[model samples]
Target: MSPFYFGWLRWIMVYNSSIRYIDDSLFIDGIDLASIVRQVSTPTYIYSLKRVGENYRRIREAFAPLAAQIHFSVKANGNLAILRSLSRAGAGFDCVSAGEIDRCLRAGAPAQDIVFAGVGKTRAEIAFAVSAGIGWFNVENLAELHYINSSADDLGVDAVKVALRLNPQVTANTHPYMATGHGAAKFGLTADVIRDILTRQSDYPRLSIAGIHIHIGSQLGDTAATLAALDAALDLLAAHPRIRTINLGGGLPVAYRAHDAQPSLGDLVSELIPRLAGYDVLLEPGRSIVADAGLLVAELLYVKRQAGQVFYIIDASMAELIRPALYDAHHEVAPLRKTDREPVVAQVVGPVCESADVLARDRELPALQAGDHVALMTAGAYGMSMASNYNARPRPAEVVVSESGDNWRVSRRRETFDDLAQSDK
Candidate 1:
């Protein structure tokens, strides 16, 4: 096969086949480049509602036999429209804070459909969650247990469903900063500690032990680490027959680069469903569900050549998307309009003051000039959620594209200078 065909096949193999080139310019679904640029403008996040639904159906079909409860992790995108889209499609939410729970509620998700997970839950946050009647609290420590119990007692509520997050000590082979299952990571409780708590379950009467939760880390491609963590949870459940649910926290990987070898959702479900035959299975998938469903479109400002390297600077910065600088993450950069010029190795950068603000290093792309539009691919997950007002750069707007790309709606408005300093004032 030719290189072009092989490359195309690789992308379709990992992500849903929604991206295509129209003439020379790239188009998402049935929408053309010029229309998106003219309508939404540049430096905006464009999400494909069709792609999100496709991903959701893919996972749902994979675990059809098991009826796994799929909770969309709010930390991935957290956009209200995106949350509402998933919620309307019959997906629950996996939240880590009161803020996230509020977002889910605003998105019209039922309180019973939300699961709260975090290493640290403040007393106020716990009280808020209790008042909201959230479904589950994946407790990480004894202190958190105390808080949940006390909060439930104060509200005069019945037993609050609790999932004990156990640290399996299984190491996921991803970035060290993203790993959460290792002994060094300050996430879940150790198995022995959880067992001791289980032994004294009567002490916290208002807290009901509903299940166990295990999350090794994010960006996990291989099944070994996740399966190992699940095995550890199953071992803990073997002695305790009362606990009926097992939550495999979200960390399914998405292909950022063409060469990424992340396993498919179908493969993961096939291997995992058999192991969780009798018990209830819950999956929290954030990145894999939405990462490829959106792209960040930015306007090219200038091109500079210095010391045998080319830098393509864009108006957007780390304040808008921080994955590249924060995690050294890879995001494919492509021109919005097709180009016939020869390809050149260039570094795509933002106008951030810090040196770590580079988006892509040593990327080969068609030669381009100023005013050209470029896109950062597979950025729907953490791109907007991690944005900040650093360097006083205003956050970009976001729009949701229809499945056919024929219609679009603005989900978030662009931030203004006044919006940035409003908190200070």
Candidate 2:
């Protein structure tokens, strides 16, 4: 491989044991991506179970000193196969809705291992979770608490474990849309409100206030804001000594670019374990665990040059992977087959009919022609989960490579035109 390709792979942080070059072609878990694309077709998602397991075990080992429970956040990627793989690996789930909880259950996760979390939990969702015997509810407001209590009471269940989500009001260094711990964000309750709730704990007799949950935001660059949020939670814990668990909501970031600065898992755990010596710890990690384990492979349709700008349009669009359009995020683009052609600076665009449909802006990539395939690196998390039927475009297929790196299968078949309107009357 050329230094350029090696540098690009390092930039995305996917140049690991599971992902590398085999005879100048990109192979994930010892299986050629081209072969998978040939079977599943273009605009497909490919995930490596080996990489997912490695990432999960890395975090689990880092927090071994604290004996923290790892709850993989389902909103990141709720595919049944992915859930089942993590469940079999001894991971619990952090679900934002009853549907996610059911997905986890259907994937073989025990009900007691799931935690229901969200700012707005519908009455039906609360009832469903309570009836399903979910282990914990990260309650954000008094209304949710009342709903959970009512649901538990109706179900003839006593002492449903609850975690009061505390809005620490700390500003984490991340995109404004992703920052949830700020005072202006509508995520968790304020300290004063939590104090009042704890003071009047007798009102909700069916609830057990067992933990304090704090999730400031996602894609956190360092531990400063997390430490600040933890300090705030500790202050609240001082007044209420009964709360034994502290659910540190997931914000651990992954390297989206070569120069992206992120906290190491070891460093983060080292700083956190001391403060949470006696308390039970729970971590909800979503992106850090699976983001780098997947890819979005799209086939180039046309190469156009207009007004001194080159655009390599592909079959995939924001409808399939919208992080670039949604968060101005970066996903390293690499050609499936290596080439010695001169590199060109061009924008990798999609077939979507919007100005924001560009996947990569002014990126240097190997010279390529129509029909050549490209892989959007680090798309395992928030890729398919956020896909939509926008522009009436059918979604793509999803394939997963086994942990052994010797086999692969299509986990989700591509959506067809008729399938798009299957729900319509």
Candidate 3:
């Protein structure tokens, strides 16, 4: 391998332990990328089950001192195999919709271990969750509380556990699109509303207001906003002695750049465990656990040179992964096969019709040609979960590699043209 290839390999390996290279071939968990492509074709999502287990165990061990419950966020990657692996490893689930809850149940997660959370929970979703005997509901507003209470009463279920989500009004150091803790965000109730609701707790006789949930946002780079939110929740807990559980929503971040300096999980846990002595703590981690565990592999379709700029067009597009188009997210692209060719500043684009379908802009990648396979690094989270079928393109398949790296299987088969129009009457 040349210096450029070595540098690229070393950079990606820093994010997760499952990615590596063997004899100039990129392998995820010891399974060669070429072998997977030969079996499942390109534009398939390949996940390392080993990495998923490792990430989950890391969080569990870090919060072991507080005996905190770690709930894997389902909105990150809801593939059945992924959820099943986490469930088997003793992970509870954090679901944002009735469909997510159903996915968890199908994946063998117990209903009592799932937490239903969302800004808008419809009456049907609440009724379904209540009937399913869900463990907790992260209530966002007073109207939601009334809905839950009424649903519980109609179902003859009493003392249904509910957590009031508070908007700490502290702006987190993240993208404005993902920020939810600020006062203007439509995620949680303000402090005054929470206080007033607590004072009138007796109004909801069927609901058990036992927890306080505060989630500032995703991809949090610092602890300032989180700590401030924690303080606010703690203050509320102090005033309301009946509230014993503190649900700290997940915002732990994963590094997209090789040199990115993200806070260590242990450091955050150390700052948190001390203040959460008497209360039950819950964490809902999504991206930090899976973002680096998987990759999106695509085959180069054309090499276009337009206006003196190089564009590597791939079979994949915003339909498969939309972070770049949606949030201007950065996901490093690496060639599956190593070469000694000098690196060039090129843009990786998809076949989407929109101009915003660029994946990586001005990235220093080895000169690639048609039929060359490339993998997008740190795409395990928000990739498949946010995918769309724009321009009538079928979505890609998903594969999971076992811990030993010796076994792999297609978890989700690629969609066909017939499958696309199956919903039509």
Candidate 4:
């Protein structure tokens, strides 16, 4: 294998073999990804209506028989266009921050359709949620319960709807940063402690117990893990009469690589729907519905050879998408130029000045060259939402293909250098 290869013939080969839909990658359609790289530059997020809609429809159809609702996790991808599209497709908002609530509202989602959640909400955020008449609050602690009650009293609003977030103390078996429901993650109130809350509800007058919410964790790769979490929550819910709505926090996993196996939402429903029987069900699905629906397209800037290893460095980096460095995550890569032969082992990295900035390690990838565009697949979830302006890098633009049509639209304008210093004196 050559240490470096970036010729026109090599480019054409990779382009032809990469995953294609209508001769375009899963997320790139109608709009020229190559042109976007030329005009707006790299490190951009591209969304596919076809792929996103498929995930949404699969979950909806799988859970349709049950009395359930899908609240798109705003923390996953807060793009207004993304939210609006999901909202239009019979989805509601699951917000952890007031900013997310505001984003949902701006996306034209009804206040009655948004559910507020998270551990640390400010007094101002509480008042904002109450004032906007958001559908429900997934309260984390007694202090929050009291604060919400006090805020509702001050606002002179009708009784506030709150769902006690109960922790089953079961391990979600995921990464620590993303796994929240385990013993001491500071997420939900313990299920036993929740028994006391039910006993003392009258102490908080302004708060009305509307439901029970429990989130096991995030990026949960196992369907059995989720079902186990659900059974635990149901056991807790069995004793509470006031609990009408049950929210199972979303951590459904999506396969970034083609061979990884993840259970369909129906598989989860098949096990859970039978258990719940007649209760109102709510799921806060952030990643699984959107992750595989997005792609981060960047052009190769240079190919470097060190010893026997090869490097395909791109214009995108941690400033544009941080999941790789932050979580040691893996995303499938494809060369824009298709090749006839199999792949070669190479390291794909970005221009970021850190050793951990590599996207893929010593992995087999199609030989790529300068001018050849590549995609980081399954980025629709934590990709752009977790992006930062670190190193003062300009963020990428997001283009969305229409669900009902074949045309694409720019959802977010690409960030520029001026954006970095615009607020500085």
Give the TM-score of each candidate.
Answer: 0.95, 0.96, 0.96, 0.91
* lDDT tens digits by residue: candidate 1, 1-425: 54444433333222346766667667777776557788768789989888888888887787787899999999999988889989999999999999999999999999999999998889999999999999999999889998888989999987899999999999998988889999989999999999999999998999898899998999985889999999999999899988889999989888887566545777778788788888898889999889999889998899999999999999877888899898999998878876657677799999989999898999777688999998898999999999998988889899888766577878898888999889994
> In order, what lDDT does every prediction score?
0.87, 0.90, 0.90, 0.78
**The 10-residue segment with the lowest total lDDT in model 2:** 7-16
Identify the runs in model 3 with alpha carbons over 4 angstroms from their true place: 1-15
Compared with the true structure, what per-residue lDDT tens digits does model 2 show for residues 1-425? 76666644543324656776677788998898999888789899999999999999989999999999999999999988889999999999999998999999999999999999998899999999999998899999888888888888999999899999999999999988889999999999999999999999889999998999999999997789999999999998898888899999998899876355534888888898789999999999999988989989999999999989899999999999999999999998888887778677889999989999989999988789999999998899999999999999898899989988899999989999999888999
* Model 4 regions lying over 4 Å from their true place: 1-32, 340-342
Return the candidate ranking by lDDT, descending.
2, 3, 1, 4
* Model 2 misplaced stretches (Cα beyond 4 Å): 1-14, 258-263
Query: After best superposition, candidate 2 residue 17: deviation in angstroms?
Result: 2.3
Candidate 3: Cα lDDT at 88: 95
- Candidate 4 on 186-283: residue-level lDDT in tens? 88898787888888989888888878888888888667666776777778778875576788878887766555654556667778868888689888
Worst 10 contiguous positions by lDDT, candidate 3: 7-16
Tens-digit per-residue lDDT, 139-238, candidate 3: 9978999999999999999999999999998999999998999988999988899999989989999998899999999999788899999998888778
Clashing pairs in 2: none
